[model samples]
Target: MLKIFLSSTYRDLVEYRAKILDKLDTVFDSVGMEEFIPDGKTSHEICIGDLKKSDIVIFLLSSNYGSLIDVCRLKEDCKAECPMKTGESHISYTHCEFKTVIAEGILHQTYKVLKGWDTQDKKEAILFEEEF
Candidate 1:
């Protein structure tokens, strides 16, 4: 079975996550970070386990939540995006939703979809067939 890790904050992206999960379930076995992480679990534990078990980790980036570290490194510690300041707003960056896809460690082949976006190239899609 193909394993995938879906990572995103619990507040904003629930609906988007559900859509992605539904599509992924049709093709591959998948898990989300929230399943293993509950009210009391430490962030470190959940993050580590999720990254370790998943063959590919899909991080859904948002304008206020983009990670600063390069995607090429799969390690836990990286510079996090600066926390948004209240009472003062700044101009947002372009393509903020999918900015996390090109991080230092991410492979170019893995997908990076923004909100309401669909895969345009089916020829490069990953298909799994049962072992003979």
Candidate 2:
């Protein structure tokens, strides 16, 4: 089975993520932080490890950049000083996952969700491309 990693901000893409899972469930093994990460393991560790094992990584970019909450630290104080190219003071966990996917030289694709546009068409395009 092809192991696929779905990366996105949870709050913004919950419905989209569900739809993807529904489609992928029959054909591929899908891993998303919301459904796959176990309670005992640290999210950072699991994300990087699973991402490396995945056949492909798909990133969903939406309007909200999302917030970074440190799972390891108490009181969510941790912030990653992202590289200059990222153009941000701090990076979220989702950002870290993206970087990991890149650093590991994993097969990946990204799709941007335009505001007020039909997402279903864009999602279908992404899925179609992935199929071939």
Candidate 3:
């Protein structure tokens, strides 16, 4: 079975995420922070490791950029600042996950969902039109 890693801002897309999971559950196994991440593993380790194991990645984007965290800064060995930490950098966990997947040269697709709108309706409509 193919493993799919779903990437998106959790708080911003709770409803959309649930709908995606429900749709994906019938076909492929899906991985996300809420129901998949194992205990004892750090967020960075879990995300990167799981992303590496996944066959494909799906990104859900919105107007909200979400929160950012400096993984390099948190490490004791790395003294250099995170390259993504710039004046206009809105590197959320979802962003980092997407970057990691790209850096690994994995297959990915992105879908834009409007913020403050009915995400389930938008997602369902889009998925229905797409091959998926």
Rank ordering of all candidates by lDDT, starting from the highest: 3, 2, 1
Candidate topping lDDT: 3
Candidate 1 C-alpha lDDT tens digits along 42-107: 544455445555566666543233232223232234332312222132212211112233333432
Rank the candidate models, highest TM-score first.
3, 2, 1
Candidate scoring better on lDDT of 2 and 3: 3
Q: Which residue pairs overlap in candidate 1's backbone? A: 70-104, 71-103, 71-104, 71-105, 71-106, 72-104, 72-105, 73-105
Tens digit of per-residue lDDT, candidate 3, span 1-132: 999988887887899999998898899999887775467877867776787799999988765656666543433432223345453443456666665665668899888776554534444234322422
User: What are the lDDT figures for the candidates, one per model?
Assistant: 0.44, 0.66, 0.68
lDDT per residue for candidate 2 within 20-58, as digits (tens), equals: 977887799998877764768677677766878899998
Candidate 1 accuracy as TM-score: 0.47
- Count of backbone collisions within predicted model 3: 0
Compute the lDDT for candidate 2.
0.66
Q: TM-scores of all models?
A: 0.47, 0.69, 0.71
By summed lDDT, the worst window of 10 consecutive residues in model 2 runs over 72-81
